[model samples]
Target: MLKFLKQVTDYTKGAVDAARFIGQGLSVTFDHMQRRPVTVQYPYEKLIPSERYRGRIHFEFDKCISCEVCVRVCPINLPVVDWEFNKEAKKKKLKHYSIDFGVCIFCGNCVEYCPTNCLSMTEEYELAAYDRHELNYDNVALGRLPYKVTQDPMVTPLRELAYLPKGVMNPHDLPEGARRAGKLPEEILDEMKETQDGESEAASANAK
Candidate 1:
């Protein structure tokens, strides 16, 4: 009889505890209701997004070496890099650079793989449209290169060196013979080297 009584008491205690928890939750809800709401008025009030917020993708066609690194790096392969050699012009003209914004995962792989740092993320997120297909773009319309002939110093020369099977062959780091014969700005060179060094260190640490 005593055992039965004890069991009943324990069950009652458990029920009371659960009820108390529910009451506490409801109290919190009521407290929140009393405070001023933090939501912004959409389309009227502007809110600044955080630094790492991924929005629209921008590509600089001029700095693009036609390497197709962006196409390879994208998780969903949203960007299509295509080119055809113009027989009369004696140069390969970019036939198409299509980005299917509908499928982009915003992983930022394309920004990292760009040899010329031409691809970057922009902070414009209000891209509402009637049709999803409207999101696709021809990259050339963004802008033309050589607005100013600011030289890049870091690209290494195209030397007949032994195979480096893995990773990018930072042209600025290569021998002079393998690189384009032109005067590069010293500041750009230093910046590239510093970035490379930091990346290498970080990679090493990650491997360990």
Candidate 2:
């Protein structure tokens, strides 16, 4: 009789504990039901992205010196740069600049390594496409800044030099000169001389 009474007391305690837990859970559910829904309507309502949000990549062509630092730093080697030295003009010009966005991880390494600050990320993250081939972007496509991105204060400063003029002559694209001269071009030599002269004058001024 004593053992049966002890078992009945333990069973009664277990039932009470189970009921308390169920009541607590129901109370939480009821409290949550009283709150407003946080769901947003897609395609019509859009949320503004934060400043640091990394999205599509933008390229500033005029600012790009073709240093290839972006290409070197890219984790997936998505940026393809084809450039050659123009012996006559004494400048490097890009033959081709393309990015395979399909393979791009958007790791921001390219933007980070760009010495001229020519690369940046935009807030346009809707990158879905029907065909994979359409995802590949060349220099011209990458150079075009998004409409929303143009309004950004941070990017507005670089608007002028961001896109190069269409007819601008690329030094590398010029026809090869008749003479294959091993020495640097006269224009380059003159510029170097002028720079040196300026530096020397500054040094003398400082000394005085």
Candidate 3:
């Protein structure tokens, strides 16, 4: 019958469409199988942290006014700002500043709200210690500059996700002298300045 033939045709078409979709799903898995492993070995190899990454806090002892601003801004008031009022100079003299890293949450509020540009966030996340008390960083320890992963000779620094080259997901198999996908922060700023200059020139020409 004509009705039976039409039904068979419709069923065959549906089956083909389903098969196509299943093939499409399998294609991605096959593509991924061809790619190399993305595993990064710890201690010997480390991934470079992103530019805006919030990690360990670096403090400047001389720049800190003992204002207790860091303590107030902190959610837990973790910064211990020990100071004495210098009667002769009539200023709060900073004695010893300390931050217990074990108790302190790495919220970066202290770094953000510091009056003086004394506090800054460093990319040093490796703060593992045998004892909890060892984690408490005094002004001296806080002021010390953190070792950069990209600069280390012993460790191999690998880029991930956004830092990787365009369409290249595997960082381990990077070609020498290959650039990142996006423009640098400096490039973006330069573009903004150029745009502003062009706009100003256009406005001046129209006014004249």
Candidate 4:
């Protein structure tokens, strides 16, 4: 009788523990059901990149003086600055400037160190091609305007979490001009300057 009672108790305890485990899993599922999915459908939907995003390189043929500053600064010595000295003008004339995107790493060093600000980083990152040779962009190709995601009617541009307002888990269907949660870097700097000014004024008053 004692042995039968012990076996029954053990079985009941095991069943209760199994039920608890199942309940816990179901609770987790229910909790997540209320939360929105944080995935992008990609190609159809795209996240708007930040203002300072560095993607592809843009070059201005007219602005570039064939200084070869880009080549000198580049870690790979990537930029091909073809120039010829014009005896009449007595200056270097840019002939053919080309950058191989396949071999070139988008470090933004060329853009940063350019004397004439001819080079700039664009948000156009779609450089996929079957042939690697097609990746090489001449001055004309580099001067082409970059396609923006927000401007594209086919793509649904969604803000990233960092760009979104506070407590906004879902970036979709957000209101236009919705300010981000925290103060901007500029705003923070302005506030700090104001506080320092106030402190200085207080110190002068105390000195008086």
Best-fitting candidate, scored by TM-score: 3
lDDT of each: 0.64, 0.72, 0.91, 0.92
Summarize candidate 2's per-residue lDDT along 134-171 as a digit string, tens digits: 88988898888754643545432111111213333221
- Using all chains and alpha carbons, the TM-scores for the candidates as numbered come to 0.51, 0.55, 0.80, 0.78
Candidate 2, residue 105: lDDT: 90
Off by over 4 Å in 2: 1-36, 149-208
Ranking by TM-score: 3, 4, 2, 1
User: Model 3, which residues run further than 4 Å from truth?
Assistant: 1-36
Q: Candidate 4 lDDT, tens digit per residue, 127-197?
A: 89999999999999999988899999999998978888988889888888999878999999999999999
lDDT of 3 by residue, 9-80 (tens): 999999999999999999999998998667899889998898887888898898999999999999999999
Candidate 4 has a TM-score of 0.78
Who wins the lDDT comparison?
4
The count of backbone overlaps in candidate 1 is: 10
Per-residue lDDT of candidate 1, residues 1-208 (tens digit): 9999999999999999999999999999999887644554444333434345576777777667677778777777668878887799887777667777777877889888888898777655665679988777667533323211113233222221122222333322333334333334686899899999999999999999
